[model samples]
Structure formats: C-alpha cells, structure tokens
Target: MKKFVLFSVVFLSLILVSILFAIFSFSLLFSQDSGVKEFEENFNIRLPRGTVSEKIYDDYSGFHNDGVKLYKFVFTPKGMKSFVSYIEKQKDWEKLPLSQSYQALIYGGEVKDFSGNVTGFGGFAKEVGLPKISSGYWKAIGDKSVITARFIDYENLDIKTLINLNSYDFYLAIYDTKKGILYMFHINT
Candidate 1:
C-alpha cells in the first residue's frame, strides 16, 4: 500500500508540475512576441495598418524582422479576411516553408552571431538551456517525423519544447512549457 501511494504521489506531482510549466512557458512566448500576444488578446490577430509591408520570417531564430511577403500573414485593423486569403494563397508552400524563410532563419543566426550547424532544435536547446544532449531528439514516430527540442526559458526556469513543424521532415513538439504553437521557417542553404 505504501509503495502504491508513493507512486501515485510522484505521478500526480509530475502532472501538476507539467501543467504549471506549460502555463508559464506559453505566457513567456506570448509576452515576448507582440504579434502572438496580440492574437491571444481575443483569439485573433489584428495586424497594424501599413503599406502592405513584407517581412522575411525566421521561424527558428524567433525574429520579426526581414522583408518578404510570402507567409507574411498580412492584415489591417479591419481587414482580416484579406489576411486569411493571403494565408490561403501560400497554402502551396505549406508543405514546407519558402526558401526565403530558410534564408531568413539562417540570417538570424548571423545577426545573433550564434555558431552551430544544427539550427532547428540543436540551436534552440542551447538557447533555451536544456543540457547540450537534450536537444535535437528525433522520435521514432513510425512514418511521421517528429523532432522535439527543449528550450530553457531564461525569463522562467521552466523548459519549453517546440513540436511538429508539419511541413518538411522537422516538426517542433514542446512540453511543460507554453509556446505550444510552432513558428516554422525554411533553411535556404
């Protein structure tokens, strides 16, 4: 009876800890990204009104800079339908991020002056602080390819995992930390 009770306690504690971590990590990511935060405000993202600006998105590095229109998700204060249309137009590239996206992500590496061969999870792990070996874990998920990388949230001590990229072979799957949604980018090189 004592052994069973102890196991239950341990399991319950782990579940509780996981829940706490998820809440905090998602908070951190949303807080950091104004766009994501804006989306969470009302379950919808209302982009600022501009001259149809373009951004070169860097999915892995997490930067909002760059100048490209593909996968841009453009929108106006009162023009989200168009935004949806824009998103739909690029459905073709949904299979994998555009080549420019990959370039943008790599460019982020240059801008940050980070040195490493593997940018997806390997770089994200070191950046998040989940022990060097804990990163770049490829799961044997049958035909489906899943790559889970743990990132240490400096703002919070909890770790976050990026899961299921969808397109391409790489996918970001995160656990215990929020940031549940994945921002995927393509690698040009």
Candidate 2:
C-alpha cells in the first residue's frame, strides 16, 4: 500500500510539472510578438530595431473621442545614446512626416511642434529632470515637431464626417535627453 501511494505522489508531481512547462512554453511562443506584429500590420510601419517594448495599453473606450492605444518602447542606456547620435546625423530628415493617408485623417488643423520650451513629453520631463534645451541634441533641432495622425475610415459614405476613430492616429518619438530613453507614442484605433 505504501509503495502504491509513493508511486501515485511522484506521478502526480511529474504531471503537474509537465503541465506548467507546457503552459509556459506556449505563452512564450505565441504571446511575445502579437502586439508588435499587430501594430506593424495595421500601421504599415516597422518599429526601430533593437529597442524593447515595455508595455502596450489598448484603451477601447476612454476620454478621447474614440480610443487610444499606447505602446511604450524602452531602450538600454547604450542603445539610447546610439539612437540620439543617429538622429543628430539625420539633421535634414524633417522630424516626423505623416504619409498621405495619414494626412487625410487629420480632423483638426495641422500637426504642431510640442518640444521647444517644454522639457519632455508625458512623465519623462520630471523623470529625466529638466534638460538643457540650448545644449546637446536639443539645440541641433531648432523646433521639435509633434505630428498628429488621426485616422478615420470613410468607406461607402458620400460625404465624409470628421469622427476621430483613434486608430493608428499618430506617433510621437519623444527622447529623454538626460536619461537617453525614447518614448515612442503610437496613438491609434
């Protein structure tokens, strides 16, 4: 009787371990890149290579007209430094340029520059401390541009309505100069 009980205990333990392992392996294989892949497919743009995505928030219904999806990507200290260097080299890139389809979706007037005078976007300003706007990469780019891309689908309608779909709206590449962290905001549907 004791031998049978011992055998049952070991078998159950092995089964439990195997189940947990399978669950973990399945999650690792299927769940890792789903959000990033969806974003790329929807927006038709690729995120910068080597950066790690920290969190993806899909706000189906929120304060905005429609909704907003926030994808926060983090970079290592070394990677941040390298990206800043690369941006400095791309002086004539004209910051963020919205594509033609993106342009049609804008409900309001035009996209504006949200950088100059302000230290940083969202919580980064306080997090990184107040950076010297006149020195380093900040000074290189005279005016920091914040381009808004608000996407709306007017498929079968004769007249278009200015409804904010909030899907794949616009992206902001906010860099924390002091900490070398780039906050890439993808406001979308």
Best by TM-score: 2
Candidate-wise lDDT, in order: 0.30, 0.42
lDDT of each residue in 1-189, candidate 1, tens digit only: 999999999999999999999999998865534433423242223333431322234344334321211112233434544433443454221322212222222223322212333333233332233221221111111112122112222111111111213222232211111211123222211
Report the C-alpha displacement of residue 15, candidate 1, in angstroms.
Answer: 3.9
Model 2 ranges with Cα > 4 A deviation = 1-13, 22-58, 61-66, 71-74, 88-93, 96-168
- RMSD (Å) of each candidate, 1 decimal: 19.4, 10.8
Would you estimate the TM-scores of all the predictions?
Answer: 0.20, 0.39
lDDT of 1 at 2: 100
**Tens digit per residue, CA lDDT, model 2, 1-189:** 999999999999999999999999998876645545544454344545566664445544755544444444466666666666676775532232223222333222232233332111132222223222222331111111223441223211111222222224444344455555544344433
Off by over 4 Å in 1: 1-5, 21-73, 76-189
